[model samples]
Each structure stands twice: as structure tokens, then as C-alpha cells.
Target: MFKAVLSDSNILKTSFDAISSIVDEVQMKADSDGLRLDALDRSHITFVHLEFKSALFDVYQCDEPLKINVDTEELMKVLKRAKSEDIVELTVDEGNFILTFENEARRTFKIRLIDIEYEAPSPPELEYPTEFEIPFSLLKDSIQDISIVSDKIALIVDADKLIASAEGEFGDAKIEYLHGEKITENAKSVFSLEKIKEMLKADKFSETAVLKLGNDMPLNLSLKMVSEEGELTFLLAPRIESEE
Candidate 1:
């Protein structure tokens, strides 16, 4: 037996919105610890991870561990109907995953679970030269700034600042946010601006994001709840430039 009740519907609404854009389906495992999911996008350009502790839920119970596998897009469609003030209950029968939203009125949706052999992906063990935290809006703004000139943005970090820069045939854009981290090494990596923007759709998840980067390596970005009850993270593969 496994079930959970969330006091706020926005938690699932915003998260799946971002997640659906990257992955078509996911296998979420719920245990006594809480609920967690890890999935790699079909193209393997991105890996996403999400964890919600029991503390994040109004009611959480698990007599035995269980897996809920479903289509991400279909789940997001149902989640979109949720209101901010609504409470959401999650459960699964043998063939269906169920969601019930309660507010002024109660609404229930049953989504058929897909049968597939699934192995939860694990985040690769990565070591970065530099890591720092910045406002979530900074990433959103930088994506806009860089997209004006190029489809790719190079992220660079020195002791003084974090930079997002891009250049195209017609123009170039650069954004610098002074990150007062006592970083000893300088690192840089280039990534797709479109992919970054896709991950930023969960703007309500966290106010700040932690970044980890190394030259020509995947970029690691993490969003955490201030209460430390939940986290959403992504590892985006870098775009490689061919040498002439």
C-alpha cells in the first residue's frame, strides 16, 4: 500500500510541467523515505531527478515500496487542472494511477499506467571545478539574453562572477552576475539555450539554483526547497564544437 496527500497542488503541477518537456515517461518509486524519480530524456542530452520527502506531504504512507510508471505528458495534462488551493491525493491500483483534487469541489482522474520494463536511471558521479548559487531569475534572463544571438550559451565561472555568453553571425550577448564565491578555479562549458530554458519552466520550485560546471563537461543544476523537504535537479550534456 502506498499513497500521499499534498496540501498544495502547485508542487506537482509545476514540477511535471518542466519534466514532461524532457521525458515522455518516468518510473517513480515510493518508499518509507518518500517519493523519488529519475529519468533520462530520449536523446540522452538531459537527466532529471526529483525527490520529495515525507515532510513535504500532508499525509504519506507506504506499507511496501511500489513503483508508479506513467506517461509524463498525460500526467501534466491532468495536473494542469489543479488549482493552487487544491489538495491532491495520489494512489495507484493494479493498472491505473489515480489523482484526486479537493477544494470547493472534488475532481478525480484515473490515468492508465503503461506496462514497461523499467530501470531507474542514476545521476552520473561528476566532479566539477566550480560550483555556485544564483537567483533563478538570472538563469531565466540569461537564456533570453543569449537566445537573441545564438542557440548555444557558454557558461563560465571565475572567482568573481558567473557568465553566460553567446555569439552568432549577426550579434553577440553576454550576461555577468557577480557570484561572491571563493572559487579557486575557473571553468567553462557550453550548452543549448533551448534545453536550459526547458528546465527553467519549474520557476516556482526554488528561488535559487546551485550550479556545477567543468570545461567540456555536463552542467549540473539543482533547485531545492528552502525547507529542505524537496529537490529537483538536472544534468545537461554539453554541446561540443568541432575544431577546424
Candidate 2:
């Protein structure tokens, strides 16, 4: 038996929104730090790594940091019916799970429990070569522009401009943002459009996005949030090149 109550369900609400689009199933690991999940999308083209502290929830309790695996797609289908301000209650009974959204009215939804086999992916240990601070909102807007053009986007980081471009049947669309002397780079790489779109969904979440680019290697993205409350970081895996 387990019970968790969120002070503002929207935290998990927005979180699941970005994750569900990428991964069908999610393996959530809960411990003293709160609830953490690190899983890649089905195609393995993108990944979502989220960390939610106990303070985010009004009531948080668990036994031995349980690892709960659930079909995120199915759960999201149910959550989509909820309103933003609704208080969400997630509980499990007899190996059966129930989700309740309580606002001025009480709405309880029942979902058929399905068994999911979950495996956690290990993160790399290499020291990131370069790191930069990016405007969160601008980055998201850039993603929208790229998506309208092609399915893939090439990111060229150099001493001059921070570039995001797409080339396809309709020509090419590129956006160059001039930065201050603070940004120092001399390299570039590319990633998929679908991955950028998924990342944009969580754009408004944090103030500045920390981008760590390696030498023609996978890019690491970290979103940092600072409020009067405290600080939080949302880390995401890089999109490595897919072999043909």
C-alpha cells in the first residue's frame, strides 16, 4: 500500500506531459529526495530525467524507496481529463491503482492495472566539455520554428552565433541568436527535431537551461529553477546519432 499527495499537481502534470510523449512506460524511483525518473523514449531518440522533491507534495510517504513502474501513456490518458488546479491523489491498493482529481468536485478514475517491466538506464560519467546558459523561453520558441521545417535540426555552436537550423524538401530554416562575449565555442553538432520539441514542452519550467556539449558527442541539457522556495535541476540525456 502507498499514498502520495501533491500540493500542486501541475508539477507532476507538466512533468508527465513532457515524458508521456517520449516514453510509453515510466519507471519511477522514490526515496528521501522525493520522486525521480530517468527513462528514454520508445525510439531511443530522446530521454527525460526528472527530479521532484518531497516538498512539492503535501503528503509523501513510501516504504524502502519503492520503484513503481507504470504505463505512462495509459496514466496520461487519464490525467489529461483533469484540470490544472485540481488536487491529485495517487494511491495503490491490492496491487490495483487509482487516480483521483479533486477540485470543487470529486472525480475518481479507475485504470486497469498492467504489469510493466522497467529497467533504469545508466548515465555517462565523462566530464562535460562545454557548458552555456541559454534563455529558456527563446530556446523553446526556436524549437517551434525548426519543427515547422523539417524532422531534424542541426545545432552549430561557434564563436559568432548560436544556431539552430533545419534542411528538408522545403529548403532550410535557420535562426541565429547573437550572444555576448560570455559564450565561447568552436564546435557544432546535430540532433533530431522530435527531441527538441519534447524538450520545449518543459521549457517554461526553469529560468535558464544549462547546455553541456561534448566533442562531437551527445549533448546534455539541464534546466535550473530558482525561487524563494529553493532550487531544482531537471537533467536530460543527449541524443546520440542513430546508425543507418
Candidate 3:
């Protein structure tokens, strides 16, 4: 048996809004500690991870560790109906994942679970030359600005600034923000602006995002709650530049 309750639904709603855009199905593990899920998109270009500590919930109980498998779209549909003030409860029984919203009225949704052989992938061990924190809004705006010029954006971190630049036949766009963190080395990588934008959909998850970058390496972006009770992380593969 497994059950968890929260006073706020926004966290769960926003997280899945971004996750469903990447993966169709996901397997979440619930234990005495908390609930967590790690999934790689079908194209294998994006890897997403989400976690919530047991302390974050108003009430959490689990007799034994359980795995909940369900379709992302199905879950998102139900979550969309949840209001900000609604109290959310999650549980699983037999072959269905259950969600209940309580407030003025009680609403219940049961989504059938899918059975499949599964193994969550371990996050790849990575060493980044530069890691810094920037506002989530800054990254979102930068990607939107870059999209106007090109589908691909190059992220560069120097001694004191983070720069996003893109080029196109029509025009080129560049945005730079001074990061007050000490950095010893410079690193740059190009990535799909669309992919990064998808991950940024969880803007409400956190005000600031921590970014990790390396020369021609994948991009690591992570968001954590103010109370440090939850975290959502993404690793996106980079685009290789070919010399003409």
C-alpha cells in the first residue's frame, strides 16, 4: 500500500506538464523516503528526473516499496483539472493509479496502469567546467529570443558571464548576463533551442536554475524547491557543429 497527500497541487502539475512533453510513459518508485522518477525520451535526446522527499508531503505512507507505471498524458490530463487551492492525494491499488482533489468538492480520478519491463537509467557521471545559477525566467527568455533567429543556440560560460547566441540567414541574436560566481575555465556547447524550451516549461518549479556546461558536451539543467524538498533535473544532448 502507498499513499501521499499534499496541500498544493502546483508542484506536481507543473513538473508533469514539462515531463509529458518529453516522455510518453514513466515508472515512479515510492518508498519510505519519498517518490521519484527517471525517464529518457524515446528519441534518447533528453533525460528527465524528478524527486520528492517524504517530508514534503502532509501525509505519506508505504507498507513496502512500490512501482507506479502510467502514461504521462493520462496523468497530465487529470492534473490539469486540479486547482491551485485544491488538496491533492495520490495512491495506487491493483492496476490503477488514483488521484483525489479536495476542497469545495472532492474529485477523484483513476487511471489504469500499464505493465512493462523497466529499469531507470542512472544519470551519467559528468564533470563540468562551469556551473552557475541563473533565473529560470532568464533562460526562458534567452531561448525564446534565440528561437527567433535560429533553432540552435550556443551557450558559453566565461569568467563572469553566461551568453546565449544564435545565427540565422535573416539575423543573429545574442543575450548575455553577468553571473557573480567565480569560474576558472570557459566552456561552450550548442543545443536545440526547442528542447531547452521544453524543459523550461516547469518555470514554477523554481525561480532559479542551476546549469552545468562543458565544451561540446550535454547540457545539465536543474531546478529545486525553496524548501529543498523537491528537484527536477534534465540532461539534453548537444548538437555537433560541422565546419563548412
Candidate 4:
């Protein structure tokens, strides 16, 4: 038997909530090191990779090393029932999984074990020419502010600022942040505002989010948790404009 506890449950919860909006099933690997999931969209364009260490959970238990795949939507449903202050404990018995989140009183949630076929795809391996860290809260806020006005927002990053703008039939919205040394770029790429908004519906965003972006590939957004914990990185493919 193995068990571990974490200081914050929202870390995992928030990660799950963000991606469940697009994909239903997600592949998860849980071991002594921690839990990890690399989920990609059907188009293979966008991906969300999450690494959670054993210490992040209030109670992490394992009889043996295991890799399990589950319906992310359903899994999130079970986790949502947990309170912020509750201690979460997971265990497997009789080919079934049980999750108990409790303080004084405990509530047991169980789901049957089912095999879900999954393929692990390699992330883009090219070296990104640009990398920088911005306050996670600011990035989250910028996404939200732009989403209200348009479904798609263009991200234009240079040496001095990160700008988000949208110019659709409904009009336009733009947010520009001036910080750091200015790099070189008069170019821009667009992304789904709704998707970014869905991604930031988490508990804490007080930390910085590192962004690695360049070329015509995907934009990587990485967030770091506490030590002994893992990070979550989201790769979003750029949306190309029609030449019409």
C-alpha cells in the first residue's frame, strides 16, 4: 500500500477542468513519481500535458505501478465533488477505483475500471526561438478580457509586449502589455478565445506562466507548481487565416 498527501487539490482539479472542454477521454499514468497525462485533440494540433507529483495529492496510494485511462469528463465529475480543504485518497480494489475526499466526514466515490485505448504522441521537438515567463494571472485575465468580445484572438508577441486582439464582425478588442526587452516581430497568430478562457477557470493564477513560441508551429504555455510537484504545459496550434 502507498499513500501520499498534497497541499492543494485545485492544482489537479484545475488542469482537468480546462481540457475536459474539448476531449472526453484522457490517458493517465500514476506511479510513485506522480501522475501524468498527455492529451491531444482529434486534429493532433493542440495538446495538454500535465505532470503531478505524489506529494501534490492529499493522499496518493498505489499497490503497484499502474497506467490507467479514463473518461476525463466523468473523472472530473467525481473530483468536482471534493471540497478545497478535503483530503483526497485514491485506491484500487476488485478491479475498481475509489476516491475518498474527506475532512472529518468522508464520502467515497467509485468507478469501474475499463480499458481505454490510447496512443502517446510525441510533442513538437523543435527548439523554440522565443521563451519568456509572464504572470499567470495576467495571461489568464488577458484571455478572459479578449474572449468576451470575440471567439478568436490574435497573439502578437515582440520584445517589449504581448498583445491580444480580435477584429471580427462584432468589432474588436485588444490588450497590450509592455514589459521586458523588445524582441523582433511584426507578426501575429490567432487562437480560440473561448478555449483559452476555458483553460483558466482554476483556483490560483498568482504565479508566472512561461511561454515558448516561434515559427508556424504550436505555442507552449507552461505553469510550475510547488517543488516535488510537476508542471502543466499546453500547446496550442496556430490558426491560419484564409486568403479569401
Q: What would the per-residue lDDT of candidate 4 be over residues 1-244, giving only the tens digit for each residue?
A: 5455654567657877877765677767777777788888776666888888776665677667776667777778997887888877776666656777778798888766767765756566756766777888888788877777778878877778878787767667888877584566544667776566655654262277787766555778887875637787788887777866
- Please identify model 2 stretches exceeding 4 Å from their true place: 168-170, 179-181, 227-244
> What's model 3's TM-score?
0.98
Clashes per candidate (backbone, < 3 Å): 0, 0, 0, 9
Angstrom error of the Cα, residue 69, model 4: value is 1.6
Model 4 TM-score relative to the real fold? 0.87
Residue 220, candidate 3: alpha-carbon lDDT = 95
lDDT of every model, 2 decimals: 0.92, 0.68, 0.94, 0.72
Candidate number with the higher lDDT (1 or 3): 3
Instruction: Specify the highest-lDDT model's number.
Output: 3
Candidate with top TM-score is 3
Cα lDDT tens digits, model 3, 1-244, are 8999999899999999999999999999999999999999988999999999999999999889989999999999999999999999999989899999999999999999997596977778899888999999989999999999999999999998999998899999999999999998999899998888889889899999999999999999999999999999999999999976
Full-model lDDT, candidate 4: 0.72
The worst-scoring run of ten residues by lDDT in candidate 4 lies at: 197-206
Query: Distance (Å) between predicted and true CA of 96, model 4?
Result: 2.4
Q: What's the residue-level lDDT of 71 in candidate 1?
A: 95
Query: How does each model score on TM-score?
Result: 0.98, 0.82, 0.98, 0.87
What local lDDT score does residue 126 receive in model 1, on the 0 to 100 scale?
A: 91
